[model samples]
Target chain A: MQKVMMGNHALSWGAKLSRAEVIAAYPITPQTEVVELLSNMCADGSLKAEFIKVESEHSAMAASMGAAAAGARTFTATSSQGLALMHEVLHWATGARLPIVMGNINRAMAPPWTIWTEQTDSIAQRDTGWIQIYTSSIQEIMDSVIQAYKVAEQVYLPVMVVLDSFVLSHTNENCDIPDQDKVDAYLPRFENAYRLNTDKPAAFGGLTGPDWYYELRYKIEKDTERSLDLFEETGKEFGEMFGREYGLVETYKLDDADTVLVASASIASTARPAIDQLREEGHKVGLVRIRVFRPFPSELLRKLLAGRKKVLVIDRNISFGMSGAFYAETKAALYNEKKAPPMWGYIAGLGGRDVPLNVIRDMIEQTIAEEHPEGDIVWIGVKR
Target chain B: MLEIRFHGRGGQGTVVASKVLAFAVAREGRFVQTFPEYGVERRGAPVVAFTRIDDQKIYIRSKIYEPDHLLVLDPTLIGAIDVTEGLKPGGWIIINSDKPAKDFPQFAGFKVATVDATSIAVKHRLGSAAAPIVNSAIMGAFAKITGFVGIEAVREAVHELSPVKKDENVEAAQEAYDTAEVPKEQS
Candidate 1:
């Protein structure tokens, strides 16, 4: 109830209460504890579900897909390399329109094999069709899982509830976990119109020729676009029931503010304090935490960031040769808006480097205090 | 604003200490932030964490090189890192050591405060005499010196992480609080 829980633990609680029937995962740092809790719950008969101890993260997604395709509520989790391994099936899960929820702890991918924290792991998979949601706090981590199930089932698209590996994962905090009944009422079963079985076995992912390929692709694109609306409708419904409303994009104190921060995952948490500090010093700074990464919520963001000038987007991951992934997405979302904010991308923490509150504060200070016309990225929290 | 830097091993609870301290300050209705600039250094390597607390809000985004309050968890870090490099003028230093507060030369021009938090942790049967997680104890002295946060709030924050031994850490911290003395602020 009121106990201090790690972000991963909070997610497991949400999954179990959501009546998830199948859990398939392999142990990995930060994310391992989440699967471990589910395994224990299933072992003790507390959770009436089949726990599939998979061979690898790749198989974990495959098995979860099979479970969901077979009309059972399915969930899984991975981090860093583990998520990289699940790359193949993530597309399959989303392509097949299977509503599988995954809890991905955002860990830095390794070359020297680092395991501390970073956002490169999840951000690299931006093109993956799953609806990705990044969380700033443990409360949001738990709440996101519950919301993911509702939104995923509504539109039949998979959702990834993401959090910083250790920042929100290992760092325990006070979270108001929703009651089981409230979640039960909010999220019903996965009664999709289509399920893969012998009784009514129909073609899923049937081959397409050039004549039908464009139409099939267009259908998927149209469904993806329609999902943003469904997400808002379900979010409003959730708000009415649980009093906690979430959106594809959340704007905090951005009204009449010239500079607003755009961030997701734990950067949102760090930016919040910096925003408070800047505001106290009479600086008009606000925050936007992204809840949906895919179906990119372009319309929602266009409205929020429309008139605001000098927006700063903080990203933990980078696309290397290209722009910051989150910042690039922010630009795409705001491209059609009448009043587009000139976004400055700030890549602060990478490879699990420490991003302190001061770094966030300084970003606000720099964004508001001066105008940089040339620099595309200002990497903070690095030793100069 | 009270900016504190903690030096310890990776698992020594330095990061946690900074977080609990921030929450304690938050209990006073102030906005604060706590974070660690951890390295690949494992187990016993010198790890550094930072804390920012202000009456209004804190936005300075730098690893505190110049700290208003510098805390040393392991006395050995005094030689390894520049613990005194950024200490504010007329600021404070709280060290976990057996030596007298006056004996530390780096704090020569500052209001230095010292306490045997390790021994206090041992007396309270908290941990080994060698290294007891002295964050709460040092924070106890921190509370008494800078007056940024009260000991009660620290105790309450400790319960968030460690409930079973909350009172023990609180008592151990209070003991350090009692022994903590500012050597008549430097002239």
Candidate 2:
């Protein structure tokens, strides 16, 4: 049925439809509602799941690890400081090869105490070995959560379905909640050979010496590489079922375009209008929204971005002294290509600051006007 | 697309009002998006929420700068904050106030309508006078004056969304719908 629902509720519906058997979460701002509704669903017997109101984010992920180890489909949701708190367990889940699905509402890390949208929280966890997918709308948030389970279980890697805090979390949008039977057919129960079973007891996450540790790390890398293909296949299956197709990267008005702007999450959604406005004014501008961040989709990006005259990346995050994390990755992805666009990076919309239509237009115009960009990263809309 | 901006203090159901309207419109087969703009969120602090309704899907996710309509849930918010800062000329402003529409400050040449939502809330005892839950009442005036959404749509929304005060909310909305008045000059 179609309903105008909050983005946080969308995550709850996704977890319900996916038939997650165990939901362990600690409430945090912007992320609190996602699990609050889940707890209600659990209490009402609508979801038929165990809702664990853990004391901390670490306990939430740790409980999910235990549940997934015990052969249950597990899930959790958190943001910002909560995600930071779960960092240690995040690595544990990945290293244990637990196919846990988590919803990370991307919020700014606080010294000033903000509960607003920012990508730094999730971007900082890029090396944690979880497959991360950022969504731009409520429907994508729901669909990605379902697809995330399929991809994670396929390759035995945890998946983080990430979206901006309020940009999507607090926004209400029309979304089609797929029929339960259709979702059941799309994502079957999690049945894996590695799950903890009383019938076949095995040691999990035990310490490994230097001889075996390196090979286990290498295997994780190899499986992560395999996830890219699995993600495409899963996306195709989802498209056939729901009629909304998704990919690691989605392009808009790219045909016969010389300039392309790249972004992720809700900012990417905001870019469509700027691209359309520019196109109407007869500027050959396009947009490439990066949906999946982990397993980076480097090959597809290199192929799509190689021939453009200019590429502008808008990152809602920074990697401190270097550049936008996405900017550095995109550049590194195309470094060896014969024909690569001169990519410029701009950091915008941190801590839930609005990214207006004019700011987007200005970024595009600046990218077009500059012959050689002055810096590796430019701060857009900073008062200075 | 019809873009709307809502003005209310924190804890006054500003976001809830936007979502209720969005869902009502979506239930009628139109695409709708609703969200709020706030910081830190202390009660009585001014806050704004936005809603967009269209026959087609919306792509823009930024805050509405130029709203086609404004729903002001607090009378005192006028002048304190620029409630009509970006309201389009000739747009509608459905405000929650007991004063006559003409007595309210002229809002940049926009059409004005007034509803005594606080009065209706007090009559129904939905919430305390200090913090009257006026979103449902304001939404009712919005539906009746604008006619974009049917009054029954608001009733259904309140019935579904309100947990304990469903009946009272529905009555509050219905009373406001019947009692709201548009200024003669604007009408």
Across all candidates, the chain A TM-score values are 0.95, 0.98
lDDT of 2 by residue, A1-384 (tens): 878788888899999999999999986554569999999999999999999888899899999999998878898999999999899999999999999999999989997888888999999999999999999999999999999999998889999999888889988899999999999999998897798878888888788999999999999999999999988889999999999988888899988889989999888888898998999998999989999999898999988899889999999998999998889999999999999989999999988899978899999999999996787999998885
C-alpha RMSD over true interface residues, each candidate: 5.4, 0.9
Alpha-carbon interface RMSD of model 2? 0.9
- Best-fitting candidate, scored by TM-score: 2
TM-score of 1: 0.80
Compute the lDDT of residue A138 as modeled in candidate 1.
72
Q: Which portions of model 2 show Cα errors greater than 4 Å?
A: A28-31, B182-187
Model 1 docking category? incorrect
Worst lDDT window (10 residues) for model 1 chain B? B56-65
Flag clash pairs in model 2: none
- Clashing residue pairs found in predicted model 1: A117-A352, A358-B60, A358-B61, A359-B61, B66-B86
Q: Which tens-of-lDDT digit does each residue in B116-182 have in candidate 1?
A: 7777777876655665677677777778877778988887776665535778877877887787875
Output the lDDT of residue A219, model 1.
69
Residue runs of model 1 more than 4 Å from their true location after superposition: A29-32, A36-49, A192-216, A241-243, A258-261, A272-287, A306-312, A333-346, A353-384, B1-5, B10-36, B49-71, B84-92, B108-111, B123-187
